[model samples]
Target: MLAFLYPGLGHVYLREWLRALVWFFLNVTSFTLLMPADAVPETFGWSELVAAAENVTPEAALALAAITVFSMIDAYWMAKRQNTETEVEEGTTCPNCGRDVDSDLEFCHWCTERLNPESDEAEETADDSGANA
Candidate 1:
């Protein structure tokens, strides 16, 4: 929604200051390049702004709109990727319920299923003995 309002605003919300500034400047440059001199609003008001927007060429509007959509998608994808990375770092998935469970727990907190601590110990012991040999 932020990106919809202005290209790269979503990045600003995501704490990507440099990316947001670049996108904001890019969109501003595009608008300046495409704006007709006659379309410049003479007054600072809603009516004047609407008139200016109405005067914008279809090509300019379409280009800016495309950039806005692209920015929104990029922000959303990056946010999701960051969340996934954090989840991977902090925990493991419960096999029984296919949900995240804390790594420190002996069983799946969601499903309450035993995680075979004995087998894990046994494997560790076997590996240690093999290393000693």
Candidate 2:
């Protein structure tokens, strides 16, 4: 939505400073290179803007529109990805060190504690069965 107004505004909302700047500069450069000199207005007004827009060549309009649309889509996807990442549970706590650790490993990465979850479950099951026998 914000990107519909300009290419970099959506990136700014996403807190991507670098991308925002890049997109902003790209928009300025495109306008500088593609916009007709006669289209530049000395005064600022809604009517002046409309008149200027009328002078934009079809090719330039297409390019600028494409950039804005792409920027909006990119920002939308990034926001969606951020939301998904935050919603998902991540990693595990190391029991020994009480620190965050990767869940893929069988040991606490920080304290080198054995946290072989599968083996521990198996052992517990075996112990319970044996005790019942």
Candidate 3:
């Protein structure tokens, strides 16, 4: 909810100070840089605030909205990652085709290539002997 309202607030709540600062600065900078010169009032007040909001360009608004969305996504994912019990290990790759394969499997699932380490060494030895012959 905080992220929805004030992008990156969720990161602050989660004690991710650096991420929160980065996201908040990005959102604020996008809004400030993209906003039209005439959009902002000379003085700060309720009426001026309303006028500024009214005068904001569609591009600036869209950019800020996109930043807000990214901030929320980052916050959500950071929190989710923090809460996760364990990190998933990367899967082993098939030597024949360089495709990821299950650790328990002995062959490349995608290419049907043999993946046994001992067999691969034996084949290498046989090839070396044949070459010598």
Between prediction 1 and prediction 2, the one with superior TM-score is: 1
**How many Å off is the CA of 75 in candidate 2?**
0.5
Tens digits of per-residue lDDT for model 1 on 15-100?
88898988899899988898798778988899999898899899988888888888889888867877887765433776677787
Model 1 ranges off by over 4 Å: 44-50, 87-91, 97-99, 109-112, 117-133
Per-residue C-alpha lDDT of model 2 across residues 60-79, encoded as one tens digit per residue: 98888888888899889888
Each candidate's lDDT (Cα)? 0.83, 0.85, 0.85
Model 2 regions more than 4 Å off: 88-133
Alpha-carbon deviation at 20 in model 2, angstroms: 1.1
What is the overall TM-score of model 2 with all chains considered together? 0.62
Report how far off residue 30 is in candidate 1 (Å): 1.8
Q: 36-114, model 3: which lDDT tens digit per residue?
A: 9889799999999999899999888888888888888988898888888454445477777787788788788899987
